[model samples]
Target: MAMMKLEHVGIMVSELERSMAFYTDVLGMELVGTLDHNTPGIRLAFLSYPGQTAQLELIEGYADRLPDEGQVHHVAITVDDIEAEVARLRAKGVRFLDEAITTLRNGARYIFFAGPDGERLELFQPPRG
Candidate 1:
């Protein structure tokens, strides 16, 4: 047997709106679609970029149910407005992991944050110089 190609990454979020803001606004990913789907014991919203097949499945309805160890680390999302996005999200009450910002010698800047479900996520500003 052979494992098929990767399909998508599933992230169980405690709050949908918080995930939406970080993925859509902060990361600048299009909210291709969302739904209140149901199967047997779970439901979630499927999100992805336009013309992209792989998706980001934001699983919800898991209130305070922490995943097993090594559930997830963090996904790097490229952003052009690192400063502005950080400010906006901060105003929205999104606490960041690091107390300050960090910029690399390659002209790239980045920061980390904890998602609504305690999912560690990162935003990176590509090298512009």
Candidate 2:
């Protein structure tokens, strides 16, 4: 069998510029590159995490249109502090989909949010002893 690793998670956004500000300025992700596709009137921007192996790909499709509801599946990122991260994001006007932090069977804490285009994104931190 071959080994597999996650390269990036693609999120379809309605506003590329707004999403860029959030991911790059607020979240501190590096903008690696961007591609403009005229045929579909969409643009794709790739972001890389510093000192990490994964990336977040943002897709802005048809500047004048919005993606259908329930289009985004979800993207989860492991954070160092769930509360602190949530606070920081909240201060930046980020809204959470749920009020309470979700705890998994393995004792991990997480929260979800809707991105610029309504893409579901998650921030999580594992419990410690």
Candidate 3:
């Protein structure tokens, strides 16, 4: 049997430099590397959480883009405290899609937000028994 763990979540961005600033400076993810897909005009950047197994990939290109209306589909990260995380991000001038806390089917708390490219990003923390 083949076992696999999630390598990274890819987000498509219109402006690479702006998105890089948000993810690196604000979100605090370390820039891992950058690559070109060789499709005439396409570039991709990889970022990783400091001292963690998760990674985020930002892809910039001219192609079919994200949906017209509604929040961009998101990649979520679990934090130790949902409320505290939200507050911290809010203090950093990050705006959230929803301020109210929500409970998932499995009983976890989460909130969603938009990144620089309007890509949805979720911050969640699982409930303790």
| Candidate achieving the largest TM-score | 3
Q: Give the Å shift of residue 64 in candidate 3.
A: 5.8
Per-residue lDDT value at 60 in model 3:
81
lDDT of 3: 0.71
TM-score rank, highest first? 3, 2, 1
Q: Which of the predicted structures, 1 or 2, would earn the higher TM-score when compared with the native?
A: 2
Per-residue CA lDDT of model 3 for 8-90, tens digit only, reads: 56677877888899999999999987766545577767798888767786878745565555222457776777778788888
Superposed Cα deviation of residue 94, candidate 1 (Å): 0.5
Q: How badly does each model clash, as a count of residue pairs? A: 0, 0, 0
Q: Model 3 segments beyond 4 Å from truth?
A: 62-65, 68-129
Q: Please provide TM-scores, in order, for all candidate models, with all chains considered together.
A: 0.45, 0.47, 0.50
Candidate with the larger TM-score of 1 and 3:
3
lDDT of 2 by residue, 20-90 (tens): 88999999998887777434666867788788767786878744555576244467676777778788888
Tell me the deviation in Å of residue 72 in model 2: 2.5
